[model samples]
Target chain A: MIFDTTAIAAMDKLQRVQFATTLPGPKPLCLVGTRSLAGRSNLAPFSSVTHLGSNPILIGMVTRPDTVERHTLRNILETQSWTLNHVTEEFVAQAHQCSARYPEETSEFEATGLTEHHHPSITAPFVLESPIRFALKLEEIIDITSNNTKLVVGRVCFVEIPDESYSPDGTVDISRSLASTALDTYFSIQEVSRLPYAKPAPPTP
Target chain B: MIFDTTAIAAMDKLQRVQFATTLPGPKPLCLVGTRSLAGRSNLAPFSSVTHLGSNPILIGMVTRPDTVERHTLRNILETQSWTLNHVTEEFVAQAHQCSARYPEETSEFEATGLTEHHHPSITAPFVLESPIRFALKLEEIIDITSNNTKLVVGRVCFVEIPDESYSPDGTVDISRSLASTALDTYFSIQEVSRLPYAKPAPPTP
Candidate 1:
C-alpha cells in the first residue's frame, strides 16, 4: 500500500503513534529506572532508547510533551542519574505494566513485584531480574522544537551483564541476554548470523 | 562482567565503536537512499535510524562528523529528501556491501546490484526489492556540540509497503516483511506475541 503524509496525517492520534512506532521495526525495549529527590523510585518502559554515539558513549530516549506529569523524566532531572534494564520475555508483563500511570509516590518496581537493585555509585535503582543493565549519568537534554518532545541523552557510567553474554570482540550477544522489542506488541528476537565487516568485493576480472 | 566509562574509554577506536553499536541490541537496519543535485544516487546501510515522534511523523538518524565526505548525508542535504529501505535476509549481503566506502561519483545501487524505484512525488529513489520503504523530507539538523555528530531529523512524506504486511490498526507485521537487524551482523527476527495494552491490575475485592 502507498501512503502520503496527508493520508497518514488523517489517522487518529493513537493510530498514528502505533504506526510510527512500529515503522522503525523491532526496537530494543528497556525499563528506565530513576529516583526522585525525595528518594522515590520510578520505572517506565521505553522503546525509543537509541545509541547516539560511541566516543562519549551516549544513549538517548524520547519523552512526550509534559502535558501531564512524567514521573520518569522528573526523577531523572532530580537525580541526574538513571538505569536502563533490558526487558526480556520472562518479565515483559511486569515491564509493560510500568507504563501504567501510577501516582508519583507509587514505585512501579514495588507495584509490579520487580526487584530493585541498587549500585553504590549511582542513586537510581536497576531491575534485579534484568540480565543486562546500564548505570548512566545525565549528559544533555535536547528539546526537539518541531514537536514538544524531549530527547534525553545519558553517558554510560557503568554496565553489568552476565559474562557469557559478552562476546570476545567487545560486542554483547543480546540474544543470550533475552532482550525483547516493543510497539503495541512484543516480539522475541532470534540471532540469525553474525557476518564479518562489509568490504568491497574482490576486483572482478 | 562489569565495565565503567573509564574502562570503555581505554579500548581502541574500532573496539569502542563495535561495542557501543551492539550495546543497543539488534538495530533496525536499512539502506538509506538519496540523490544529489546532479541526480546521482547513493545507498548506505545505517543502523542509527530511529523514530523520533509521531505527531509530526519525525525520524532521526545520526551521521558521524563529516571529517571525511559522507555521501549519504551529502546527498540528503543536497536534495532535501531521502528514502529508508529496510534490509532483509534475502538481500543482506548486497545491503551490507552498500557500507563500503565507495567514491562520491559511484552509485551504490549499481555497485551493489540493488534496483532503485522512484515514486512520482519524491525525487529520492527507494530500493525496489525492499518490502518496506519510507520517503522523507529533511526537517531539521541538530549538531551534537560535544562530539560534532549531526542528528538529522526528517518528516515522513510518503511510504510504500507490501499490502499484506500492514495490519488493520496501523501496525506493520515486519516478520512478514523480512526486516533484519544490523551491528556487524544480520539477524532474522521472530515475532513472539503481541500483547494487549498494559493497564493497572485490578485491586483485590
Candidate 2:
C-alpha cells in the first residue's frame, strides 16, 4: 500500500513509529558501552551505528531525545570514550535487555549477566561475548535541525575481530552477526554471493 | 587480534578501508534514485540509509567526497526530492551495477536495465522491482567537520510496502530483503524472532 505524508501523519503514534522505523530495512545491531566520569559503566543497544569514514576510521550513531539512551549519551559526552560490540545471535537477548530503563547506578552488563571486559588503554568497557569490538573516542556531536536528535561521531582507537571472520583481503564477514529491524524484530543473515567490483557494461552490439 | 590506532594507521589504504568498513557489520542496502532538474535520472546503491527520526519520518545517508555518489547528492540538492528502494536479492546485481560511474547524460535505470516507475505526485522515479520504496524530500544537510563527508537528511514523503511483508503492528518484515556489507558482500536475511518491549527486571524475591 502507498502511504503519503497525510496518510502517515494519520497513523497512531505506535504505528507511525513502527512504519517509519521499519522502512529503512535491516540495520547493524551493536551494544554501545560507555563510562561516566564518576566511574559508572553504561550499556545500551543501538542499531544506528554507521560507518562514516575510513582514513581515520570514523563511526556515527543517532541518539533520540529520549531518556533510555540518555545515560549512554551523557557518559560518552563526559568521558569522551565508548565501545561498540556487535550483537551475535547467542547473546542478542541479553543485548536487547540492555535497552531497559535501568537506574544510573545499574550496569546493563551486570543486570543482563553479560561479562564486561576492559582494555588497559581504553576507559570504556566492552562486551566479552561480542565477536567484534571497537574502542572509540568521541570526535563530534552534530545536531539534526529538522529533528531534536543528535548524531554522535566517534574516532576508532582500537579494533578486535574474530580471527575466523577476518578475511585475507582485510574484509570481515559478518553474516553470522544478528541484524535487527524497526524496534523489535531480529534477523540472521546468510552470505549470498560476493561480486567483483562493478564496471560500466561493455558497449552493446 | 587487537589493532590499536597506530597499527590501524600503518595498514595500507585498501586494507584500512576494507577493515574499517566491514567492522560495522551488515547494513541495509538501497538503490537511491533522484532526478536532476535538467531531467536526467540517476540511481546508485548505498548502504548508509539510516532512520533518523519518526515524528516527521526523516532518513539520513552519508555521501562520500568521491564522484560516484555525487550525481545522486547533487540531484537531491537541486530538486529537493529522491526515492529509496530496498535492494532485493533478485535485482541486487542490477542495483549494484548502478554504482558504476555513468556519465551525467546516462540514467543508471536504462544502463542497468531496471524498470523505473513514477508516481503522479512525486517526480522521482521508483524501482519497479523493489518491494519497498520511499519517496523523500530533502530536509537538511549536516557536514562532518572531522571529515569532509556530507550527511544528506530527507523527510519521508510517501512509502510503498508489500502487503504480504507488512504486519498488523505496523512493522514490516524485511527478512526477505537482501542486505549488503562492506562494498561487495550481499546476504539474505531470515527472521529469527520478534522481541517484546524491554522492561526493567523486577526486584529479586
Candidate 3:
C-alpha cells in the first residue's frame, strides 16, 4: 500500500515512530558501554550504529534528544571513549534489559548480570560475554539541528573478534553472532551467495 | 583476536576498507533511485542507508567524495528528491550491477533491465519490481571533513509497501522481501523470536 506524507502525518506518534524505525529493516544491534567520570559504567542497547568511513575507520550512532539525562551520551562526552559489544542470542534477554531506565548510579552490567571486561588500551569497558566488540574514541559529535538528535562519530581504536569469524576478504561472518532486529525480534541470517564485483555485461556479438 | 589501531593502520588500504566495512556486520541494502534534471533515471546500490530520526522520518546515507561525477548525489542535490528501493533476492544481481560506472546521461533502469515507476507526488522514480520503496526529500547535507564523505539526510515524504508486508504495530516483515546484505553477499533472515519490552525482573520474594 502507498503511504504519502499526509497519511504518515495522520499516524499517531507511537505508530509513526514504530513505522519509521522498523521500515528501515533489521539493523546491527550492539550494547554501547561507557563510563562516567566517577567511574560508573553505563550500558544501553542501540541499533543505529553504521559505518561512516573506512580509511579512518569511523562508525556513527544517533542518540535521541537529551530532554532527559542521557547517560550514554553524557558518559561518552565526559570520557571521550566507548565500546560497542555485538548482541548475540546467548545474552539477548540481558542485552534487551539494558534499555530499561535506571538511576544514574545503577550500572546495567550489575543489573543485567553481564560481566564487564576492561581493555588496557581504552578507558571504557566492554561486555565480556560478547564475542565481537570494538573500543572507540570519540571523534565528533554532530548536533543534527533538524531534530534534537546527536550523531556521535567514533574512531575504532581497538577490535576484538574470534579469529574464525574473520573472512579472508575482510568480511566478518556475523551469521554466528545471532544479530537481532527491530524492537524485540531476534534473527539468524543465512548467507545466500556472494557474487563477484558487479560489472556491465560484455556486449553481445 | 584483538586488533589495535596501530595494527589496523599497518594494514594496506584495501584490507582496511574491507575490514572496516564488513566488521559492522550486514547492512540494509537498497537501490537508491533518482532522476536527473534532464529526466534520466539513475539507480545505485547502497548499504549505508541508516535511520537517523523518527519524528520527521529522517534517513541518512553516506556518499563517497564527489571527486568524480556522482550521478545519484548530483540528481538528489538538483531535484532535492530521491527514492530508496529495498533490494530483494530476485533482483540482487541487477541491483548490484547498478554500481557499475554509468555516464551521467545513461539510466541504470534501462541498462540493468529494471523497470522504473513514477509517483505523482515525487519527482524521482521508484523501482517497479521493489515491494518496498520510499520517496524522500533532501533535508540536510553533512560534510565529513575527516574523510571527504557526505551524509545526505532525507525526510521520508512518501512510502510504498505491499499491504501484507506491514505489521499492525509498524514492523515491516522483510523476511518475505528477501533483503540481502554485506558487500556482495545476500541473506534470507529467519525470525527467531520476538520478546516483550524489557523491564527489571520482579524482586525475589
Quick one: best TM-score, which candidate?
2
Q: Tens digit of lDDT per residue, candidate 2, span B41-98?
A: 9999989889988888999999986868999988988999999999888988898899
lDDT ranking, best first: 2, 3, 1
Candidate 1, residues A104-196, lDDT tens digits: the string is: 778898899999998888899999998889988888888777777777888888989899887666777677333333355666676655677
Better of 2 and 3 by lDDT: 2
Ranking by TM-score: 2, 3, 1
Q: Per-residue alpha-carbon lDDT of model 2 for A69-184, expressed as tens digits? A: 99999998899999999988898889889989999889998899999999999999999999899999999999988988999999999999877877767788686788888878
Query: Candidate 1's residue-wise lDDT over B1-205, tens digit each?
Result: 9998788999888777777777766567778899999999999877767788887789988887552228878888888999988877788888877877777788889989899898889999999999889989999888766566777899998988889887767877677333233356777777656677766667779
Candidate 3 C-alpha lDDT tens digits along A145-172: 6777877899999999999987666677
RMSD of each: 2.0, 1.0, 1.9
Residue B34 in model 3: lDDT = 91
1 against 2, candidate with superior lDDT: 2
The DockQ leader among the candidates is 2
- Clash pairs, candidate 2, are none
Candidate 3: where are CA atoms >4 Å away? A67-69, B66-69, B178-182
In CAPRI terms, model 1 is classed as medium
Q: Interface RMSD (C-alpha) of each candidate?
A: 1.8, 0.9, 1.6
